[model samples]
Target: MKFNESLFDNEQTRKEFLQTTSALLISLSALSLLHCSEEAPQKPSKNLNWITTKPEKRPVMNVAYSPTRILLKNGIIIDGSGKPPFTGDVMINGSTIEIITPKQINFKGTTIDCTDKIIAPGFIDAHSHLDWILPLDGHPELKNPFMEQGITTTVTGNCGYGVAGFMPKSKYLAFIKNIGKGFFSGDSSTQKDKFVQKLAVSLTSMQQYLSYCRQHGIPMNMANLAGHGTTRMSLRGYESKPLDKDEMKTMLYHLEQAMDEGAYGVSFGLQYEPGIFATNDEIAEIAKLVKKKDKIVTCHMKAYSALSGTYPLKPFGTPHNIIAINEMIDIAKQTDIRLQLSHLIFVGTKTWKTCPQALSIIDKAIDSGLDVQFDTYAYHCGTSVINVFFPSSFLAQTPQIYEDKVALLKLRAQLELIVALLGFGYNDIQIINANNPELAKFNGK
Candidate 1:
């Protein structure tokens, strides 16, 4: 239709506005498509890819002490001797329990009023894996968590992990580098050298870590047990085989060296990989060495179930699954070697009503003057690596055989969730490495 010049100008303005709106709409649609493509799901496959970012760095605090020595006044002391607690003042010099007294003494140290507090030797974690998980530099949480629980010393290298000697020199160097950078600040070069030397010696045993404590003034003291699984893996690859004559000689030599190095004893995890491959004879040979050294032999026994259905072999009645415990008892009887069973409940729980009977067997052994003891955690749920869920028995009797993988998956998820809630990740969960430098390097990080 014919229109005036003013109408034409207005029509042009409206046309321009509509064109701009249309362009914007097209741009928005394209952006949405791009976003969707980035988030598109992958094809159904066996592998699931998940990416987690590193946790934020915690704040560093400048902790200053007026005097490096701390004196506790009028505290009840329980010295871990299984003795009665008594009132006393304790003096700590560096990390050692220097002095304890019923009456106050004139000392040039900073005094703390622990008038009513119960003082005891810091709780000793008989079994721990701190070498991997707890950073060398020590986090406030790491230090505080144990300190709050009254733990001053922790025993690591349990279940075939944290064996420093099993690692290569290069790997050990990297471990020292990480720990030095993270845990200590001044004169680390010397500290690193000393730590490396200790590992080198400890390969034969944990005596080096112990010696290092006595030699260079340690902040905390530790004791360790030689891992039978680690030794077997070192001698033979992950294959199941008996040791050859020369291999046996070498293994014995190393075992002797470790004993001489002051290892508290040898720990065997019969349920774990290479350890599962070991024969009773091989274990007895090692147990003999432990006895000769007058050291304890601790074992994570094979089976934790009493149900005949749970047995790997039917009608054997030889208790193939509980063979490790039976073997240990036999060894103790024969060699008179002291033995400690780790986590007595899991294995004893399955029989339900027969729990007392199982315990009685241990008690009878103790009464017969056999050097045997057992330890247990105060909780029902246990945390172990996901790989531990895999079946290793010949019968393939494991959770994997069950159609419902839900229980296993739920257990893993619960552990991860708890760890995350505690402000940690898998990386924070230490992996034990003996010969792997790449793995050892993570300890410092």
Candidate 2:
């Protein structure tokens, strides 16, 4: 889930998720709007990157406007300054704010009585997967759940996985959208769906995809990141190998081209395929490219647990979560690029106490002049792709394990240990959307 408008507009939701979101310095949250207010307080050193920046002066575009524009009246204006809220009236001329004043302005146009309601800037979902709609030839549902939540802008192509790398199949879209057992319809016995029938979906390049989407119109404003996983997959499909000289050159060319085509930056899904296999050196090279472009880097770390991750599969002196933190920090330090850690969570039960240590590492890095920050989910519980909790080798050898009774028992034993380590049993993990029909009966059980 992305940070929607509810993070700012909806009081209960905000308080439910975060008692104080003061640490979201680098995020696209309305917290950035604090610096935009003339009455806003000075930016603190901890949030150094939140310094106010005045855009280059440019004339407003001369577009024809409707005579009667909507106006909001008698609303409590929350300027997002972390200051006290004030009562005010806001006048609008189309999407442009004509005025925001405490004193009443007598207007004859359509007026919306926002009495006792909050009038804040439109929210930005910095970690959105709206890029999931990339495969649709046309007709994007304008009234989707995001819009219902008052989110006007979204940062798409997050988690470094999307249609960016491959032509999305109906099953893939279904899986991402949580569309029931249809996503796992790999067998002939499954019901045939029109959605499953392949359609002509081209435009693999960043510019082409973006241009196509614009031509079709969108529900909200979006800034997309080129998926590092997708980029690797495009070049080498699921090949868990290091990049050679030629391949490195090609990858650079592809990434640079995406930036040039207006991708916001690069995102790394270190826990996911192609990205999981990515060597530190390879990641460094990509980060360096982002540094050259002066764009941001977002990463989903390799592991969030005490004893699991890509680094040596397990660490000796340090925990896997700490190693993951250092990995991103070191990348930022080396490349001097702005880095954002996506959904920083202590995965297993044993690692729950590692919170302070993780924050300490990040705090020290930021104190030392590194541009680093992170975001987290509201609750302690989470869900993940099955591969996350199991060894990749175990997943790869699934058929073999099933065939050997001893191996199957061993696998079950390992799962039990992992479950206990996670501080929850299999029962705690609710099946929101099971992929396979054979598993549909287990949903919500």
Candidate 3:
């Protein structure tokens, strides 16, 4: 059920799932290419002394390194500031690049011989889901997938599904239980249910998560966005309903806390559950809070379903891509918040041919004084939850509630709609994986 490219490139897949996209093209001739060390350098542990003592006394690394002079000789340097490549020697004093010149420099400490290799600043992964990936995989010391690719920093917690605040234990239990039903599986059974069950229970807040990363020694730096979906879940428990005044206040408080703790901004996965239930006004209210902090707002707009003309199931004209974009633009216009359109891409035949028109819309927005930006990958296929196409009514019910006769009948109807919306035969609907013994046989059929 995954739309390979869409899901991977989508904003908050990390909250529900993680995706991998293979780049098919490389711009080797580009003047600026990222280069990084093979591994992270060793630094004295700062928090080890407080491990068993008062946790409040634990020291976290928050300062830059003192000046240390090192020189690189004879390298092709491309300073990522869009400058042309030049052959030179670069000097580093402490954390800053002191100079880059063609002249030879006599220096103390280490001098690396770089006759052909490119020297450039580390790459910044503008978006990622490492917040959930690192904790789940327990590989903070070796974030090699990114490190090896020259990625020196990552901004995570995108798509309103961050791991910042805590959820009530009961809600956490229910969420975990629901995912175990294999509703989240991908190309394989994944058995994420077993993994989720085994995950250490202490990962409840963003601060604690970051502390874990620092304690484990992450190879790269990390930043975060407060997740709107997680906040909604914490308050409403996937009820698929609007928030009352008090609930909204609580959510705002959580967002404020996350921002004070260093969240760069906020994110929304309006295409998914909880967020899907959020009204335009509700989204605006949240974005207003983000604007108060003078931070950006990222959104996975409620566009695709509306564009496909399959959603608003009973109520047509429920804001498609153009409307969704306008809504975000309007929010930004009203609040003066920077807007980031997460993983912008055109989907389906209905929208694919209109790529030029889409770009024109964005261009017009920029011309109109709106601060808008977007990110995308070269891949075409996207991935998403198989149940995404399922109607909201079916989604609102808990897995336990779906075992009844009426619920089973509803499930059949929902499946039929999904098939019709897909407008494809069984061959196109390849079975990725299924937990049910009866359904597993259809894998790859």
**Whole-model Cα lDDT per candidate?**
0.53, 0.62, 0.60
What tens digits encode model 3's per-residue C-alpha lDDT throughout 1-445? 3233332232433322211111111101111111113456688654433212232332332222334767776676777988666656777887888777655666656678876666889988877766655544443343666788788888887777766664545355355334323322331333353334432245545566567667766557888888888767777668877889998888888788778777888999877677777888888898888888999888887764324322444323432556667777887778777889887765543344456656777888889998899886544444444444445555666454444545544544554443354332222333444434444554443
Model 3: lDDT equals: 0.60
CA RMSD for every model? Answer: 20.9, 13.1, 13.8
Candidate 2: which stretches are off by over 4 Å? 1-67, 81-83, 134-143, 165-201, 309-317, 392-414
Residue by residue across 244-305, what tens digits does model 1's lDDT show? 78877776676666667766778887666667667778888888988989988888776544
TM-score of every candidate relative to the true structure = 0.58, 0.73, 0.69
What shift in Å separates residue 94 of candidate 1 from its native position after superposition? 8.0
A best-first ranking of the candidates according to their lDDT comes to 2, 3, 1
Best prediction by lDDT: 2
Q: Which ranges in model 3 have alpha carbons more than 4 Å from their true place?
A: 1-74, 93-96, 104-116, 135-142, 167-170, 173-201, 305-310, 313-319, 397-445
Best candidate per TM-score, number? 2
Q: For candidate 3, which ten residues in a row score worst on lDDT?
A: 24-33
Candidate 2 residue lDDT tens string, 1-445: 1223333342334223232221221011221111123475666443322322211221222223347576677677766778655666677886688776665556666778986567888777777666654334333342366776768888777677643433333223332323212222223332342222321134556777677668866677888898887776666666666889897888778778888888889999887666787888999999999999999899989878776534444333577788889988998889999998988877555677788999999999999999898877544455455545545444445434444545544545555555545443443445543444445554454
- lDDT head-to-head 1 vs 3, winner: 3
